[model samples]
Target: MTSTLFRALLAVLVVGLLVGQSDAWRRRRRRRRCPNPTDALSGAQTAWDATFMFECPGAQVIRRIRSAHCNTVEDRVWRFECGTVPGVSRFDEAFWSAWLNEYNGVMNFQCPFNAIVTGFRSEHRGNDRKWKLKCSKVNGMTTFNHAQSNYANEFDLPGDYTVPSGYYLRGMHSFHDGRRGDRRYQYQICLIDLP
Candidate 1:
């Protein structure tokens, strides 16, 4: 009967649609190194600012933070919220002291830039988002020539920034001179986009 044929055709169509969807999913799973479903949901979240540094091809986006350390979510949020460089934290008291002695006391400056300076920041965080590390006191060094950059940031120390885990350092980049002066003191950080 035509009625039976109609039902049969409908079932076949449904099956074909399901098969196509499954194939697409399979293809996606195979393509990415991290087979985790969460990873699939969160694609690359990198973003960049148009005008920070002229040449930072490595990170696709880079911006400077003379005082604000956007490496941690806490610092980033403060910078984002105030739209200025965040003041040094209680945790950074030691660094502030050392820095003051190391260099001419860096004024409690503001976060400088707000966009990624480069397109290539490494993925330091895993799927977790709650890393409870703190910024430490750095001594005896006015300029740290870490892989971060040649320019020294008033806020950037080194190692284990207290950014929450799983959150990832997605698109940091704060500008310097929270006080406002010549842009020469400006520093930049280009972040890899977060999910």
Candidate 2:
């Protein structure tokens, strides 16, 4: 009877260990698929360096790339230095250009403020579209003022635009003058964080 009881206890102990290990593995897998702010910015050690790093609320890890675009997956922030922005396919770009042109190069898009600006893609792609800074903040809101003429080839704004308080920069898009069929004119999209 003593030996049998001992064997039973051993089996239970082994089963418990296995169950605990399994649960731990599952937690790890889930973390990899969905990381919080802490996980996304895990290795950041300093404040904004005025070049790559920027100050983000509750972000434990922060990184930046000068001439690249941000590619977010799960809790990881990756960079792509290729021609067009990573994750944005060529098909999507063509569609956007055509649509922006039709709409007089005026568009407004917003995203959540969960992730701050890690980098920006300023390289002009097709349709002779380029980055332009119309305006940054207007009455506590980020606004993109459409230019009267879409013929400007490059950024001709008065100065660099900065994000206002409680706001963050997301991304940018270009829209050509859809009315005149002019490839030289396009609306420079300024994507911002939604309230």
For each candidate, the alpha-carbon lDDT, in order, equals 0.26, 0.30
Model 1 lDDT per residue over 1-195, tens place:
999999999999999999999999998766643223223222212211111112222222122222222222212111110111123121121211111111112322212222211122211121111111111221221212112223343443311222222111222222333233111222222222221
The TM-score leader among the candidates is 1
C-alpha displacement of 118 in model 1, angstroms?
24
Q: Estimated TM-score per prediction?
A: 0.24, 0.23
Name the top lDDT candidate. Answer: 2
Model 2, range 1-195, lDDT digits (tens) per residue? Answer: 999999999999999999999999998777655333233344433211111222222211112211211112201122222122222221211101112122234443322222223223122222222322211222223334322223323222111233333223443334444332222222223333323
What are the runs in model 1 whose C-alpha is more than 4 Å off?
29-195
lDDT of 1 at 23: 100
RMSD of each: 17.7, 18.0
Q: What are the clashing pairs of model 2?
A: 41-60, 41-61, 101-178, 150-185, 175-186, 175-187, 176-186
Q: Deviation in angstroms for 114 in model 1?
A: 26
TM for candidate 1 is 0.24
